[model samples]
Target: MSKADVVAGIPGAIGGVPDGMASGVLAGVSPVHGLYASMAGRFFGGVGTSTQLMVVTTTSASALAVGSTLTDVDPDQRSGAIVLLTLIAGAMMIVAAVLRLGKYTRFVSHSVMTGFLLGISFNILFGQLPSLLGAPVRGSTAVAKALHVVLHPLDFDWRAAVVGLLAVALLLGLAHTRLRTVAALFALLVPMVVVLVLGWTNIGTVADTGDIPTGIPLPHLPELSSLSVPLVAGALAVTLIVLVQGAGVAESAPNPGGARSSVDRDFTAQGIGNIFAGLFRGMPVGGSVGQTAINQSSGARGRWGGMWSGIWILVILVALAGVVGRVPLPTLAAILMVAAARSIDPDRLVAIWSSGAISRTALVVTFVATLLLPVTAAVGVGVGLSLLLQLNQEAIDLKVVRLRVHGDQLVEAKAPTALSDNEIVILDVYGSLFYAGARTLQAKLPDPDGAHDPVVILRLRGRTSVSATFLHVLGDYARRLDALGGRLYLSGVDPRIRDVWTDDLLHAQGIHIEFFAATSTLGESTLAAYADAEVRVHREQRP
Candidate 1:
């Protein structure tokens, strides 16, 4: 590597190493696993991914979830399960790539992203509250622990806590001001210096970072005998949520020197990283948005930035392993808190809330899910709620109107008065015809107990395709219309959908087809039909 590459990569790798180790500790795993994953995963992903600055680490959300799920399992079982899930998730990603499932990742809307990140910010912030107060490292969830410490801070080491708090303040100040790239190191070191120099409060203090193992992690079979179905399900959910979040980070981030990223290439890189991580008994790896932003802001030039960092981390660990163990936990928490604070995007949250009720609802759902549910389950719940809200919105958008006869003309009570109660009644479709949306159309039809109007007109300018259930329902409606002394009229259909209708049995029922252009003649055809029907009505009245 070039001199610049060495300089940039060393710091990046060092920064990544601590975070990864801490994350593993936080997730109730051995620190070595975190190191192995960071070293190997970063190299693989960095080389393969399009975003040169992108880094992968254990996320607070995923860590919390993994901790919760694995905390109850026996040690052997937990290790086995983690390995199993890691491999499974890696396999799933490969399958997704093969099947071109990348499109699904795009479906996670802006609201979900904003809500998820905001929730994470809160999680990280709340998690650090006890540490800032000099409380013991305890509690499963952030809020619970914060409350516990607040209600009763036991044997609080005021001096050490002060050092940690100061460190956090410095880091935050540096980040908010001009000097953000070196914030992590400053955040870690300042507290160390304060504690070591003054010998303040005999709390454990680090002289330097600890030695790193020289060799790579040994491969061992992860025990799977104790793995339950629900555990596997939760792991799968975690993997999916991580993938979704990672893809967003990859797609949205600028590459080295402020360039765009190729999402596919990024995914390929992440896949490679995870595969290596699995081999090394490490958990799954994905892109870290905060880390990427930090690297970009730090003036990293190319992939060498990450590669150099990896090498530097290994060297530093070998040299400073003993010193690293002396590092205070409070200081680490403080640094994490500062990093979390920087990630808070209040404006994005406001935008999501302002978009509309549906988006607002999705945000609320996701935010609440993250707070209330276990980490792994939270993703599933949030995504489920978001999708459910979308479906409900589509349902509301889908509509059906009754077209009735008035002396030899059909008319519908839709906007723009497409038909003049003369030729046909237009049921204007404004949304998708998915499973949930199909109900709205079914409800708007005339009751079977009464004599229905003849020649029902279905203005299909907006409908793109029909599901099996939707097709079946429409077929039923068409059959009913035919039996009720009426015929179905289809207009304003795009050729793509028209082709399906032509081949489908639903179109076999007696119906009239009109090439009403949605941009033009759809309204004209309805108006002309209504006008002709009005003339017929007048003639019948005269007789």
Candidate 2:
């Protein structure tokens, strides 16, 4: 929003281009398209959408899905699809704005988001192999295609190859230096000067950028019918992932500037940018944390910084469209390689891999899924796998310790609080109870055998959100208690927990809910509810 924010956003935006293009290449489309969309979409959205310190650009997941489905095998088809998806994704953003679901991006968790980002980083490196070595990228499998490129490096254009390699070296050098912001420009410039001085080295030139219409593209609505159902579904997944990534950073950004990013507004901004880009058959866009940080670092002074960058791009595109052709593709690839290399966090990856069997499995599954499938699909798969593995672990860790009233004090049912005519049994809970926690509830709860009536009180103060599965399990436990001539008393549910536990979907299946106060340092309201329940139960059993 401020000049400082815009300045910081620029370098990150520029750095993101290669990643975006690499995604396009993976999707079997022109890499150049990614660059253009990122440049324009970011500038306009950065300035026009909101005063938030963020950038909009082509995302890896979105590009991959659009490239795979819309592009088809034909380059033209692929290009068309990229253009179409860019517009479609943009339209979706606009719809989000109109509907005001801007805050919906808040629900994604850090664990899932980290998994998506780390998984994509690996895939980006794999995607770049063909261009890095000068081979024609082919094949559906990432590993096989990467190997093919490596094994047949000689088949690539040598002149282009040499320049690309040099670019990589230059970018790496600059990135580690005090002048990383201008790294890409210098990388491109070096190749341009060499070609001009030596006179066009038989190597393919970027002059083939072809003719992009000189007039600015008019805004238009998306053609939803033309894009297939799979493509839309894939787009939705990518949209959610990108929004997750964007919101994650904004929510966590140090509030030093006293201006935190609004997830819903950012989403609307992205949607608006997409519409603009889509109208022009450009790339789909989303908020970029990298770019937002760069803008801050670069000394930008408000929303104007983004506006100025957009203005700068328009001027450059209009005046120097021809110059784009002379730029070397390899040089661009080299810059990208450097960024990708920097993005991988070996320390973090190792920690995730070695944490435990479930974590290790999640890491492996995410890695494998990222390489084998489209990024959007990969995200969905990784999320599903992570949830499954997490749930399995929760089920094993849960121990529904049964406590019962012995005289005036409650104690473990095994000895001090053993079941008696005058005793009431309580199942104390301590863990999450979401989709991943359902199995624990099922396993820890005892089966009712109707011989002795034991009162069951469930304490859910520490538990998180409740899923349908968990509610059903709890319902069954309650019913069993009822059958055994006992009562079910639920306590220690905070307002947040109460809201989740009482959802219509679960309530429709017969789950009578209760609430209580939280007993923590922060002072929760659930504790009072628990006290009230205890009093009611004690009164009912009085002689």
Candidate 3:
């Protein structure tokens, strides 16, 4: 590795310390789990990812997702549940990669995703309030706990709040200076030193929650007993979150060498990383946006930058395992709070809000769902929103344009509102013909009533597939036209579409109509269908 790669890895590794531990707190587990994830993800993920500089690590979103996944498990079973959840999510991700399902992540609605992410950021900020203030509160949800903390300011422990707020201030201040690379480290260190000097035994430490293990993480078998339907569903949600975030990281941090990264390869890389993290008794890990930015900005020269990051984390773990436990909980909370604040993108939110009611509704609903519901349910809501947006677009986008054969060049115009007697109309369709789109097209088609002996030819060029709904719409339209002494003809139909259409009951109904398969030359099928229509019209008009 070059000196540049080695140097770049240092900053990322240093930054990973506080972020990893804080992420562990976020996941409602031992801070060391996040530490383990940091090391394991970088070690496994960095080796195989197509994006060489991409650092897979403990991200806040993935941590919160882990917490939500194990919310219902018994306290004693949580450790095993964490491992099982991570393993299931990893397995699912590898399956997705094997099936070449990476490209479809792009279809996720931008507005919905933005809303979900923003909501998660806010949730993180709110959830950390109790720890940040060192206040005891009772509430079922993050929002409620935050509200209780807010309403009962007198209950706050001023000492813990000062420590947390001091860390926050230092983080914000150093962010503008050249020392921003190590600001988080100082944020944790300064507060711990102050608390130690003051002898504030009341302030909770990382050790208060659990024992801090020394040395490198080792592999452990997952508790197969913890596996359940709920765990499987939650794992699916975790998989969705990681894959989507991985796609986003790729977009933000492109390869410096102008090499295009394979999405599926990166997906598989994350899967392997998570699998290793789980085996090593770590929290869930993924392509972290913050750490990837850190690696890139540090001038990472190659894949080794990321690989060395894992090594650096291991070095720090061995050296400072004792000091790490002495770190204050409030300081960790402060680090997470600052991260949450920086994560919000107001400009994007405003842009989505200004787009239209459809966009605004998606953004608002997703944001609300994320706040009020569990993380897995929020993810489901976001997915449902995406499907709704897709169906809405398909229905709105479908259009029927009239195409007239003028000598050699076909002329385009608005389709007729109603077909006329002894007339031939050629219509070309645009947009999807599936589900709601087919229904929309059926509604927009020209009425065949009072149009005797009329012939309408629909050009289906370039369409290799059709939904069953499309066939039903066609059957109904054909029956209408035939009942009015008219006929509907399909031109340029693909052989595959013909096969399906021929097998359905709609084919029997289509007997009154005719369909012509596509040919090598463009418009050949339509032209032939049109000529036949003219002959049929003339024959019908003959006394």
Best prediction by lDDT: 3
lDDT by candidate, in order shown: 0.64, 0.61, 0.90
Off by over 4 Å in 2: 1-32, 47-51, 71-73, 94-115, 215-226, 251-256, 393-421, 434-439, 446-451, 460-475, 491-543
Displacement of the residue 423 alpha carbon in candidate 2, Å: 2.4
Q: Provide the lDDT at 218 for model 1.
A: 58
Candidate 2, residue 143: how far the Cα is off, in Å: 2.0
Query: Where is model 3 more than 4 Å wrong at Cα?
Result: 503-512, 519-521
Instruction: Give the better candidate number (2 or 3) by lDDT.
Output: 3
In candidate 3, list every pair of residues with a backbone clash. Answer: none
In TM-score terms, which candidate is top? 3
Q: Which lDDT value does model 1 have at 350?
A: 78
Clashes of each: 24, 35, 0
What's the TM-score of every candidate structure? Answer: 0.80, 0.80, 0.96
Residue 377, candidate 2: how far off, in angstroms? 2.7
| Global Cα lDDT for candidate 3 | 0.90
Question: What TM-score, to 2 decimals, does candidate 1 have?
Answer: 0.80
Please give, for residues 1-543, the per-residue lDDT of candidate 2 as tens digits: 555554555566455544554444555555556656666677667655444556677665555555545534355455565566666566676676677775655433334555666656665566666666567878666577777787876677766677778788788778778878777777877977877787756655554433434444444554544567766765676566666665655654433457665666777777777766666556777766655566557666666555555555555556655565576666656655566567677787777667776666666667677777776677778667655655676666666666554554556654222334424455676566766567666665655554355555676655556677776777887666666555566665666766665558445865454445456632233334435556755775677
RMSD of each: 5.3, 5.1, 1.7
Question: lDDT tens digits, residues 70-106, model 1?
Answer: 7677764665566666666666666666666767776
Ranking by lDDT: 3, 1, 2
